[model samples]
Target: MENKLKFSQKHPLLFGFALILTAMVLIIGAMAVFNFFFFKAHRNSFFGTKVGVVHINGLIADSLRITNWIDELAKDNAIKGVIVRINSPGGVVGPSQEIYAALQALARKKKVVASMGSVAASGGYYIACAAHKIVANPGTLTASIGVKAKLTNMQGLMQKLGIAEQTVTSGKLKNAGTIFRPLTPEEKKYFQSLVNDMHDQFVQDVARGRHMDIEKVRALADGRAMTGRQAKEAGLVDELGGFNKSLDVLRLLTGIKGEISLVQGPPEKSSLLEKFLGKLTFKEQILGPRWVFTYE
Candidate 1:
């Protein structure tokens, strides 16, 4: 020890560099240990069965994260079931369908339950239909089964501002949904047909997911939002309850006498700019061009 102290005194700079390197190694090791335990706690338990949770919060603008969560839960043998907790008014059609599809695939491997929060309608309900069963609070707003595309005519505003612009397209319908002017009759019909087709697809998926007849679903798929109780009465929801009720149903489905641990995906990380803007810049609010159709 005296010789090491003498050596350190003779090479203080080298000793300081070695101390920093040792400190860094210790910190890295501590972080690794912490991450390991954290991941284990979230994914499984040493003494209980596990149930994974997939959160669908706010607008359903993107499916990659949600789908990846579902897929991870599906591959995890420790996860006997999954709960999809939804608190959204819905969003774009493509992402909603993707989430639904991912849930459906996961359902085949494990029991899946949908739990609706305050507002789970339109695309939210669409995704829930893919679950084995759905539970919603009686007062939850849900089941707005329809598609819509909003278009704005900026011609008058532009005229008032004395702004003029022109665009050239290969086809007459190429700019059918441009905000510069009102749509022509033909363009209107074309867009209407598109909306109708998407709406029909929504109804079909709902009917299939809920195991209800197509005609029965059509009766309730009028683009009007319904309360959870109303949806239950209309055969759109499997049960009328909240998150705990859904967990109970999951327990019943899994039939695990042992304790059940809930696992959830990692929280999403946001950039400093996104944090500053908050949800005002959520992807759902500004996802696409004027012609983009949505399940909102």
Candidate 2:
């Protein structure tokens, strides 16, 4: 009764190939699930005393935000400590304060540390002031305690191009920096007051953060950059050492024995992309030292 030469029985090789393909798909799927967990688990490191390096490696503009990164450190219980590594020229007033506030808030939950890079001046130091401790290299450039407002007077350019600007406002200061006209005395006084007030705030914040006298911080915060060793002398920083030394302090403070994880505002690999983009706009190129997220 030579009945059943079943289809799969007759062609075992085909069945074997199907089984192999199914096994491979399942394996790949399992790996993808594992990867998802791995990434999510590492995120906890940001909040722990895990020595996460927050790189502020650019201009100190009001728009360049760093608060979001700090917020991450705030929430991560494993991130018991933080190291804000800064290298910037100290940008405008408003943005720098935003970063300082984020650090201040984060400090409530965890100890924050500052690790200055090649440069940490003006707004960079402003951002660093919020940290409980500041570390820098012997040649680190830190300090730039002042406020600045850029005024581009394009009145002549507008006249040359025969461009006329029309405006009607309820307030006299509404069009203070309008490109069509030069600044008036009233406008000058108004803008100067704003800059001066921000400078005073900067000095006060520094003095309070470093536990130095307001007058002393005022003297050193003359919008001038300083070497790390010199900064240590002036009480701007606690010690003269690189990031490793900062990590040692972090380890002592938090007692975490894991590899340092760096969570920067923007990735360094994107720097080349920045250069190409920077050529198109002056605002885009300036490195800012400020907290980024409004509520990160």
Candidate 3:
């Protein structure tokens, strides 16, 4: 028999090109399947009357997600009102304030009600003030209005371990909160002033949101966590009840006679890499980073 080359051997270049194209298609299909399973968005009907629920769970590290949800609810016509369910101890000052501001803006367009859960203190209560009404469980802990900065001095540990860190700065206050050594008196005073200013901002915002006198808010803004009943007495909470109570309040406010459907935001989606490294926080990555002003 005469020797004959196979089709793939005769067309090596075309075979290679076909393999590459097949890989590309497979990759795209896999990506589509992954997105469908993990990153699909929540779908809400545009015609039905719905009430949006924004849950502020755990620490408020970043405001991007919550603020984006608020913006979406604001533009959605199907969402007649919103119930902000809070269950957090507190978090970073800047992010907390951003969430509060976003809620305030949303409250202007739609009826916003805050429903406090087991523990909604500090920054949690700060955001709740932006709502038109606040409902809390009788045993719920709320209102820890204060600013705090936590720093650690690692000088002794470094000295024992013979590890030294050399830092160059332009000014005396430039590297204020270095963990290499204890804070100087001047640094302490400066940090205290910053904390006071942030606390004042918190007090002023709470007063404005609750429609109470600044002094009254100042009196209660002593970093004291109070029960829902106590907060109601102090004019910080509007009502004492749980989620169902909040639903009735929203129903009454929006005049929704029939079944009130609760709409929540889509599940949080993170990249595959983020899922693996989400818990690792490198605090020393920043220069002279020791103090973190928070509402805890």
Q: Which number leads on lDDT?
A: 1
Model 3 bad stretches (over 4 Å): 1-48, 270-288
| Residues 1-296 of candidate 1: C-alpha lDDT, one tens digit per residue | 99989989999999999999999999988877785677655434434678899999987766777888889899999898999999999998999999999999999999999999999999999999999999999999999999998888899999899987698999999889887788999999999999999999999999899999999899888899999999989988889888889989998998966566788773565687755554554543555567678898
* Model 3 TM: 0.80
Q: 123 in model 1: Cα distance from truth in Å?
A: 0.4
Candidates in order have lDDT scores of 0.88, 0.74, 0.86
State the lDDT of candidate 3 residue by residue for 1-296, as single tens digits: 12234656888888789889999999989977776566544222222469999999988777777899999999999889999999999888988999999999999999999999999999999999999999999889999999999888898999999999888999999888887888999999999999999999999999999999999999888999999999999999999999989988988888887656578863465687764443333232211346788898
lDDT of 1 at 176: 92
Show the lowest summed lDDT stretch of 10 residues, model 1: 39-48
Query: Residue by residue across 69-93, what tens digits does model 2's lDDT show?
Result: 7777687776567788887866656
Ranking by TM-score: 1, 3, 2
Query: What's the CA RMSD of model 3 in angstroms?
Result: 8.7
Clashes of each: 0, 26, 0
Clashes of 3: 0
TM-score of each: 0.82, 0.72, 0.80
Question: Of the candidates shown, which would achieve the greatest TM-score relative to the real structure?
Answer: 1
Task: Report the error of model 2 at residue 87, Å.
Answer: 1.9
